[model samples]
Target: MAEVNYKQDMPPKGGYAPIVFQNIPVKKYFNGYTMFAGFAAITSFSFYMYYQNFKRRRLLKIERQDAINALEPILLAERDRSYLKQLRRNVEEEAELMKNVPGWEVGTYYGEPIYKTVPKEKLLDPILEEYYAHTSEKAYDDKANEFLWR
Candidate 1:
C-alpha cells in the first residue's frame, strides 16, 4: 500500500511577483484672473443691490409723505380739532423715533436730509393751512370731493 503526501500543496513552482502600485500627486491649475473676476463680480452685485435698496426706500418715503400731505387738509376739515391735534403729535413722535435709525436719509449719498435741514414742527404746514383758509365754499367742496375719491 502506497501513502499519498499532501504536505506543501504542490509547493512553489515558479518565481511569481506581486503587483506594485505607484501614487502620482496631481497639481491643481487655476487662472490668475478667475479669483479677481469673482471678487469684482461679488462687489459689484453687492453695490448694485445697496443702491437699489436706497432708491426704493427713498421713493417709498416720498410717496408716503406725499399721500399724507394730500390727505391732511381733508382729514383736518372732517375731523375734530382735538383728534387732529392728537394725530399731529403722534406723527411728530414717530418721525423723531425714526430720525436716529440707520438709513434715515435713505438715498442721500452725503447723508443729507431730503428737504430742509430742520424738521417741521407740525405735519400740516402753514401753506396748506392758508390754502384751506382762503378757499371758497365751491372750491373747497370740489377739492374735498376730489381728495376723497383719490
Candidate 2:
C-alpha cells in the first residue's frame, strides 16, 4: 500500500483537515467544520441540562426548608403549652363551640334560667351585707327536676 501524505495534499481553503487517530493507523474523525460544529452542539446541550437540573434541585431544597421552618414554631408552641390548664381551656372552648352547633341544642339538659331560679337577696337599699340569707338549698335541684319533666 502506498503511504498517502494527508496534510500536504489537503489544503485549509478546501475545508479538509486530517486527524491522526489513536487506534487506526491513518484515519480522520471528520474532515471539516462539521465536526467542530457537532462537538459544540453536544457540549452546549450537556451544559444546559446540568444547569437546569441544579436550578430545580436548589429551588426544591429552599421550599422544603421553608416548610420545616414554618411548622417548627407551631410544634414548639404546642409542646410548651401541654400543661393541664391549657388542656382544660382547650376542652372548654371546644365544648362551647359544640354547644353553638345547632344540632346540640336539642340535647341541652339545663332546667331553667339559673339566675331566675336561684333566690336573690333583695333589699330596700342595696348595701353589701356580711350576713348570709339562705337561698333555698334545693333551688338548683328543683329547677333541674322541672326541666326533666318537660
Candidate 3:
C-alpha cells in the first residue's frame, strides 16, 4: 500500500449556516378585505334563503287559513242539520217508549215540568246501552262482533 495525504473539509468563516429548524411562514392567500367580503356574501346569501323560506311558509299558512275560513259556514250548517236530526230521533224514541205508560209525558213526570229554568228544555243524549235497549240482543251482538272483526 502507498502512502496518501487527504485534506480535511472545514466550515465557512461564519462557522456554519444556521439550521432551518422552525417552519417558515407562507404568504397569506386571502387578505383581510377578501375574507370580510367572502363572509358578507355567505351571510347575505343565508339571510336571503331564510327570508324566502319564511315567506313561502307564511303564504302556505295564509292559504290554509283561507281554505278553513271558506269551509266554515258549510261545516257549521252540516253540524246543525245533524244535531236537529238527532234531536228529532230522540223525541220520537221518547214518545215511543212512553206510549204505554199512563200520565207519563215525554218531557215531564206525572204532569210536572222537568225543567223550569229554560223556556225550552234540551233533551240529553242517550247512553249507548239505553239507546239500544229496545234493539234485539242478537242484532247488537252481531254489530259488536262485526266491529271487533273489522
**Winning model by TM-score:** 3
| TM-scores of all candidate predictions against the true structure | 0.32, 0.32, 0.54
| Per-residue alpha-carbon lDDT of candidate 1 for residues 1-150, written as tens digits (9 for 90 to 100) | 999977665536775576677877687565669878989999999999999999999999999999999999988887667546645564565567568787664323246744565464534343443344433677557865786877
Error of 1 at 78 (Å): 2.8
Cα deviation in Å at residue 126, candidate 2?
A: 56
Model 2 per-residue lDDT tens digits across residues 1-150 = 999877555556867767766675667678679888999999999999999999999999999999999999998887666543443554465466677665453213343332564454432221122111122436435644676788
Candidate 1 residue runs with Cα over 4 Å from true position = 1-32, 81-150
List, residue by residue over 34-136, the lDDT tens digit for candidate 3: 9999999999999999999999999999999999999999999998897667557766888998899999877677678766774545656656565555567
CA displacement after TM-score superposition, residue 104 of candidate 1 (Å):
58
The candidates, ranked best first by lDDT, are 3, 1, 2
Weakest lDDT window of 10 consecutive positions for candidate 1: 122-131
lDDT of each: 0.66, 0.59, 0.80
